[model samples]
Target: MSHAHDHDPTVPREALIAIAAVLLAVMGLAGAVRLGIVPQSANPELSRAAANVAPAQQRNLRFADREDGAVLVTDADTGETVKVIGFGEGGFARATMRRMAKRRMHEGIGPLPPFTLTRWQNGALSLSDPQTGETAEIHGFGADHSATFAEMLEGARS
Candidate 1:
């Protein structure tokens, strides 16, 4: 006995054409933006809020993991323990540090130079690695996460 299908398994021709047209439009827009034919809008989430302003304060900080899973933020210049983030707290700070540390390890660079945390004149905070030239704008992470780094920055001298 042979069985007959109740419905066709193929997509409509119009659907395929629509999909291709949408894809081509997206590609063209991207190309135009990349070639500077179309201006790209600044993405607040991915951009530094205070890029044009001077930093009101900057701290060279070293992050160390304690045996019990806590993270210690120390002033690199003064060698002072600035903030001790208890285990389970400071999720953002810990995650950011881990990402930078992993990159350094992959590149075979030791943790001699510490990261710089800056509070801009506009009150935006940012963390930067001088060794790798990587920067994370703290303000982009939201107020709560930004506060974590802001507190650490407050502890260090100018």
Candidate 2:
């Protein structure tokens, strides 16, 4: 005589509950990070590099875009026109003006007054909107293409 036995493999109820709890905790943590409730860590090297960077040599360039599609690059100290970047002109200044307009529209803001671009003593290039009192830092100040705007500003002073 022979007896046959059958068995089924199954996870314990406790294990299933534990797994669900872990998943929920992970999701909650992710949501917190996405909502900026938890601040992210910064790279130490980048922070050091930023701190050690030299100040910008030219720090007086300011720019303003008019309602009539004209861009005026000026000196911040003297308020003199550095250059007149005309509409449809293919240049960095014009491109920057267009970008500013697009950003304003995206933010659901109305007409924007002139903005000022200044290179700070700490080598930070900033663009400030007078209307909204908003300032944005430009990271690509010393790049080759950015030389056009810098050159224009320098030329205007002379």
Best by lDDT: 1
Poorest 10 consecutive residues of model 2 by lDDT? 149-158
Candidate 2, 4-65: lDDT as tens digits: 55555789899999999999999998888888897545533245367775334443555567
Candidate 1's TM-score reads 0.74
The CA lDDT at 8 in model 2 is: 52
lDDT for each residue of candidate 1 in 24-85, tens digit (9 for 90 to 100): 99999999999999877864323444366676898999988899999888899998899999
Name the runs in model 2 displaced over 4 angstroms.
1-35, 38-70, 75-79, 86-91, 102-113, 152-158
Clashing pairs for predicted structure model 2, backbone only: none
TM-score of each: 0.74, 0.43
